[model samples]
Target: MIVCVAIVGHQNNPLYIQSFTEGDDALKLHHVVHCSLDVVDERVNNPKKSGPMLNETYLGLLYPTENYKVYGYLTNTKVKFILVTTDLDIKDADVRNFFRKFHAAYVDAVSNPFHVPGKKITSKTFAERISTIVKAFGLSSAG
Candidate 1:
């Protein structure tokens, strides 16, 4: 199941974060997402190992934790979508599906005239859509 989600800007700064697990672990989850940036950077610079980075926007697995596995997707504009889940053996196609939906939601969020680029997303529509998407992964907000 997806336990946490984050949208980060090109500068490595977090724009939004949502967690499906209870407690004050959002901070910890943020660190987890932040650390994954290095992996994204590695793949970005060494694109060959990951195939044609220009065509394949999905960066796939960023890293795995004892309790969760992190997946990352990069946009041409340098924005990033990071997802953390307990499902260690998730398929690449499934991750791609998640990112495809997420990218659309992200685009919708940023396209809003009221939205300020690189800022936290506060759109209820975006949040609701994400809540539904996360439901497919089996959750919304934990506590």
Candidate 2:
């Protein structure tokens, strides 16, 4: 299951962060997300010389803790999307799909005329869409 989803800005500032797990794990998850940013930066700066992934946005699984796995996606505009999931055996395609849908939702949210760039996302519609997306995670690609 997905425990957290975060959107970090180009400057490494957090644009949005939401936790799906219960209890006080939110702080730990936030720390995990923050730490993953360094990895993202390193990957973006020092990409592989040869491979299809050289220009791909999906960074795949950044790192996996004993209890959770972190995945990252970087947009052409430099926005970063983070996903923390408890499922250890998840497929790469599933993670990619999740990021794709999540990214689309994010784009729609920020497209609002009232949305100030770099500001925290506070739209109820965005929250609802995110909630729906989170709940639907991994369900579509099950085969």
Candidate 3:
């Protein structure tokens, strides 16, 4: 199951971060997400280390810890989306699907006239959509 989701800016500043699991591990999850940023940097900086096309937004599995697997997606605008899940064997298609939906939600959230770029996302509607998406994760087959 997804334990955490994060949106970070190009400067490594967090825009949004949420943890679904109920426990004291929110800090741990946050640390894990933070550490994954370096991996994302490495992958983006050294394209030869990654197998996929350089232009692809999906960076695939960033790394796996004893209990969580982290995935990353990079936008053309240099925004980064991070996903942390306990399901270590999750399918690539599922992760891709999550990013696609999440990115759309992010775009919609930022499109608001009052939203300032680089500011934290505070839209309640966006939060609700993210909650819905997280709850529906892995329930349907990805195309």
Candidate 4:
């Protein structure tokens, strides 16, 4: 199950952070995502030099905690999708699908006339979209 989701800006600042874990574990989940940023940064700068780079967005599993694993996807515009899941062995396709849906939601949010690119997303409809994504994927819920 997904424990947290984060939308990180190009400059490494978190634009949005959603914790799916209940109570104190939420804090721990945030830290896990925060630490995973370093791995995302490294992968962005020095991507695997061997394989055919069809779409360099999916960075794969960044790192693992005892209870969760962090997965990262970087958009062309440099926004990041950081997903923390309780399952350590989550499939790459699942992560990709989630990020794909997330990307669409992000685009929709940014397309709003009053929305700013780097600011935190506060749209109720956008939040609902994300919540639906979590439910569709049988993810955990926040406290």
Taking the tens digit of each residue's C-alpha lDDT, what string does model 1 give over 41-115?
A: 988887766335555778888889888899999998999899998875666877788889999988988999999
Task: Rank by lDDT, highest first.
Answer: 3, 2, 1, 4
Clashes of 4: 0
lDDT of 3 by residue, 33-77 (tens): 999999999988888854458779999999999999999999999
Clashing pairs in 1: none
TM-score of 3: 0.94
Model 3: CA > 4 A from native: 49-52, 141-143
lDDT of 4 at 40: 84
Clash count for candidate 2 is 0
Comparing 1 with 4 on lDDT, the higher-scoring candidate is 1
Error of 1 at 119 (Å): 1.5
Query: How does each model score on lDDT?
Result: 0.84, 0.91, 0.92, 0.83
Identify the leading candidate in terms of lDDT: 3
In terms of TM-score, the best-performing candidate is: 2
**Regions of model 4 farther than 4 Å from truth:** 139-143
The C-alpha TM-scores of every prediction are 0.89, 0.95, 0.94, 0.90
Instruction: Please provide, for model 2 over 26-116, each residue's C-alpha lDDT reduced to its tens digit, 9 standing for 90 to 100.
Output: 9999999999999999898888756776978899999989998999999999999999988868888788988999999999999999999
**lDDT over C-alpha atoms for residue 25 of model 4:** 81
